[model samples]
Target: MRQQIDGAVVLTAADEDVMEYLPNRGVFMAQLLGRDRGNAFGFYRGTMGPGCEISRELHTETTETIYILAGQALGIVGDREVPLGPGQMMHVETNVHHGLRNTGAGPLEFLVIGHPDF
Candidate 1:
């Protein structure tokens, strides 16, 4: 048996399958769009109120890229913490310990894309 998938069949932000992950006080609205047994890809919209943040974690095989949409946040890339604002992008490699924190007056909003959908 053989199955075929058209990657351009049209996948939307809403149709990507949204899920909420509230880890260490931060909020994540994840939209999963692609998958292939061992690999997957998705986008995550994160929200963080005052003093909110995500716990540092490492990826086994997945990598991530994030785009700041609104507000400001502190992005921990490896050992250095980078300040992020609107239009800023962050790329986290696999096995790297990274996290995000809201350090602004308002809520933080950003888009995160990752592999394996994890």
Candidate 2:
């Protein structure tokens, strides 16, 4: 039997699933593309309010990339902290530790893509 496939051609941010990632940090994430939809990767948009941050973490099997859309933040890739702002991109190798903290006055918005899904 042939396998059935269900997916959308366009994913609207407004219709995506949003999750509050941290407590009292004003960090929110919206899954724009998901693995359950038969995708080879996971894509999400994260919004971090000023002073918000994601603690250091590593992905054992997935490589991740973050593209800054608006505002600025400090990105931790591996053991170093790098400044990131609008139009900047950061790549995290597999099993590397990474995180981000919003340091700008406005909300930080960015797109995150992970290989092999999350």
Candidate 3:
């Protein structure tokens, strides 16, 4: 069934479907369920506060394309670092190490889309 959603509504997917995660480094407060658009892909929404960072990590199982919805972030992908702000998108393949950080002085809203039925 096709339904409409407002930013305020809650959604679920994985068993612990809640999207917000409070990490010691930053705030990940908003999460949106990725409605499958066919294939083995899904989406995840995350909100981070200023200085919030996604620790350096690699993906060996699932690949994802992350898009910045608001604010700005610094991404460390491989041996390079790049800055991305609202409306920017980056594609990351599996097995590559990459992470994101909210370098801006405000909260960052972004989405990370992944694939495969995990």
Candidate 4:
């Protein structure tokens, strides 16, 4: 099913059902847009439980951007470790090793966008 607004697709919580868990990462993602939606990039909502982390990895051809929605996070982007909070955004270039650790007492929520489909 699809939800649209002014001819544009809108993905809401109710429109998501499939949550993909990253192996051993304690991270879950719900894809909102990608090839299936005829989009050139992938859009997703991700959640990480407190004290959880996502291991460093790189997408050879994908540029990624993540915006924090709630809680705190430590982002490992390439050779730097950056602290992130709600309303903050991080951009990672293609082939850069990047990861995230939930540093808040509560769940860490964020939106992720990857170009060329993630």
Best lDDT goes to which candidate? Answer: 4
**Tens digits of per-residue lDDT for model 4, 1-118:** 5666675876575468657465736788888888777467788889999999888989998999999999999999988999999999999999899989899999999998989887
Task: Give all candidates' CA lDDT scores.
Answer: 0.76, 0.85, 0.72, 0.86
Q: How much lDDT does candidate 1 score?
A: 0.76
- Model 1 misplaced regions, further than 4 Å: 1-19, 32-39
Could you arrange the candidates by TM-score from highest to lowest? Answer: 4, 2, 1, 3
TM-score of 1: 0.77
TM-score of each: 0.77, 0.87, 0.72, 0.88
Best candidate, TM-score-wise?
Answer: 4
Residue range 28-77, candidate 2, lDDT tens digits: 99876668763777888999899989888899989999999999999998
lDDT of 1 by residue, 4-108 (tens): 366444444444444556556556574544465325676566666778888788988989888899999899988999999999999998999998889998888
TM-score of 3: 0.72
Candidate 4: stretches off by over 4 Å: 4-7
What is the lDDT for 102 in model 3?
Answer: 91
Relative to the true structure, candidate 2 reaches a TM of: 0.87
Query: Which 10-residue window of candidate 3 scores lowest in summed lDDT?
Result: 7-16
In terms of lDDT, which candidate is stronger, 2 or 4? 4
> Candidate 1 vs candidate 3: which has greater TM-score?
1
